[model samples]
Target: MRQTGAVDPTLPPGWPAAVRPPGAPDWEHTAVAWLFDLVPPDYRAHEVLRRYPVLLARFARDHVAAGLEAARAGWRTVRVELADDLPADAMEAAITAYEREGARLASAARGVEAVAGALRGERWVPRL
Candidate 1:
């Protein structure tokens, strides 16, 4: 891979700090590492993902989006489904956990998208 200049400080929202902006030195390596962090440890066994970073980005994006969806679904159904078994305070805590997880996954989704774009050779330019 070709090496580029220094990293841009003005990264867009949801851009992961672990990944250098596209074209920076060893940026692809860092991007691959960050993408692997989002996936299951078992995924590390896959040589294809290691060889091809763009595919890893796609997998991370889908995984994060699924997690966000699962969090939303749990948040919607927790009250009705578990109200009988769980105490009110426990239920409240569960809801709060789901909300927090949902927000985190949403941000992860954006981050994965940005990383995927970068892996595909997209560059970020700062505005005036």
Candidate 2:
């Protein structure tokens, strides 16, 4: 197993670094810092995540999980009912587009989950 006290080396520079408590490396703050590059300066989500990372984490876990489930269901529908009326290759195109968008949303959700993990105050490292 990887060392819990070690920060994930894969994390880009300036990501919130965490280690064991007594000083758990302030890793939770990294999630907020990480968002700046992904979103606009005035984005309201940034403010909420920055000020209340734990809450943001919980909200993300709850809502994003649901959204992903719904997305999966919709994707299933698209796969099952291939369209004869729509443009040729439309199903493939739609799946590709959905995969791209879903990956982005999943990345954001993972960020909040990472922040929540940090809040737990155990020896911290990113799960590979």
Candidate 3:
């Protein structure tokens, strides 16, 4: 099992020392620790052990999709800030792409939760 508080020793090239990825609460630790609170002790020990790889893979994919959405949103904001100089068609396209990617991330996150719940013998009730 991947330790929640374990840091990734290797950093990507050109990554700033002080800069961390968006939604990363702590650069020195994996987000697994945060998830510990969501599961029962017994479930955490076993369910996480069994389902961690799937959960982590889904999480990574969702994180990447979210990052792409954020980048698109940031670019849109920058363009808007530049006195509406950005092309309207391009801006709309970017917004649509962001929404689609955001939806994908949302779906992935829900999938992770559902899998966790199933592993812990809890019923997964999707909202809508």
Candidate 4:
């Protein structure tokens, strides 16, 4: 077996710790998955990356944008629907939940947008 050198400094902070399951198709591909998962729990981005693969680079920006808008609306709706009788702490917690999810969704959409931009020769790197 070949001795490995240190991890690439340019990659994400914990990229060196990325786990590659046994029987992976390729190291580079698995690394990309690890990179995508870095976005965390925003499985939609990973799903798009996996499903469309090359297509995501060419398409799906609009879909991602729409999804981001929807997430924002959902978060706003939660706040607007809050009851006057609800405890302040409870309302804050509920809104925080929406904010967190909305942020994650927005990030996921941006990840997809980055791929689209990369396709157009933007500085962003395409995950695939």
Candidate 5:
């Protein structure tokens, strides 16, 4: 069993540094803030999200997953879709941008999943 106060080195990549380990005090508040960042600014206007964080985490997860998928699709077709409008160099840059955004969205997706699990009272345990 892990100590309550120990830093969790086993947290998966993309876990927000701002959120304390599960079972720590006020971790959910920090998680809500981080989760809000992943979603659209308009989401902040919803009082329900503030009142119910687990629901917010679900929304964030869906939003980030969709973004990742869109980035992948964009990267795959940007060249052919925009070839007539963009110069060769510009097309290369667009592809690079899509690649970078896809990576970022992928990381956000992982982070949101971890946060959602934590919000649902799940704890990570280390195995020998």
Candidate 6:
């Protein structure tokens, strides 16, 4: 059976397959679900479930922004540490990774927005 999200289908039995857009990487797609699970059960039951879309959008946007900031900081650190000795290939690889991860994070944020819009009765629905 296919499983969904960061809940680790392999780690737990009966975890539902994470619903996500086609071609989304497993890591990025699963991150949202992992975040959802991080909320306290009581809050999820009472507050999150009722306003999941809005909450999710906020959560995703914050997460992506934080990640981008961290990545930028890390890149700066790498540059400072290596200075003129920096390996061109390694720097290129780091840049590529940062770009890819950024795109993934932006996509996830968009997904959250779409969910929020749907919850607001906006007719948008993510393709399963």
Once superposed on the true structure, which residue ranges of model 4 sit more than 4 Å away at CA? 1-52, 57-63, 119-128
Which residue pairs in candidate 4 collide? none
Task: Please write out the lDDT profile of model 6 over residues 1-128, one tens digit for every residue.
Answer: 24334443222222224444323455334534544653444544555644454565466557666876777676567666766776889877877787777666555555555444433445433243
- What lDDT would each prediction earn against the true structure? 0.84, 0.55, 0.46, 0.50, 0.84, 0.52
Candidate that scores best on lDDT: 1
Task: Estimate the overall C-alpha local distance difference test score of candidate 6.
Answer: 0.52
Per-prediction TM-score to the true structure, in the order listed? 0.87, 0.54, 0.39, 0.45, 0.87, 0.49
Q: Give the alpha carbon lDDT tens digit for every residue of 37-92 in model 3.
A: 23345645565443564464344445545665675676567556744665878777
Residue clash pairs of candidate 5: none
Which ten contiguous residues of candidate 6 have the minimum total lDDT?
Answer: 8-17
> For residues 1-128, could you state the per-residue lDDT of candidate 1 as single tens digits?
22333344566567876787676788889889989999889999999999999999988988888889999999999999998999989999999999999988887888898888877877777777
Rate residue 14 of model 6 by lDDT: 23
On lDDT, who's better, 2 or 4? 2
Q: What is the model-wide C-alpha lDDT for candidate 2?
A: 0.55
In the range 1-80, model 5's lDDT, one tens digit per residue, is: 34434556677545777676666788788889889998999999999999999999999989999999999999998888
Which residue segments of model 3 deviate by more than 4 Å?
1-78, 81-85, 125-128
The residue pairs that clash in candidate 2, if any, are none
**Local accuracy of candidate 2 as per-residue lDDT tens digits, 1-128:** 22534555654222233312214354444454554434445644456656875655565567666766766666777766767645758878888777776775676566546556656554345465
Candidate no. 5 TM-score: 0.87
In candidate 2, stretches whose alpha carbon ends up further than 4 angstroms from where it belongs are 1-7, 10-30, 33-51, 80-85, 125-128
lDDT (Cα, 0-100) at 52 in candidate 3:
65
lDDT of 1: 0.84
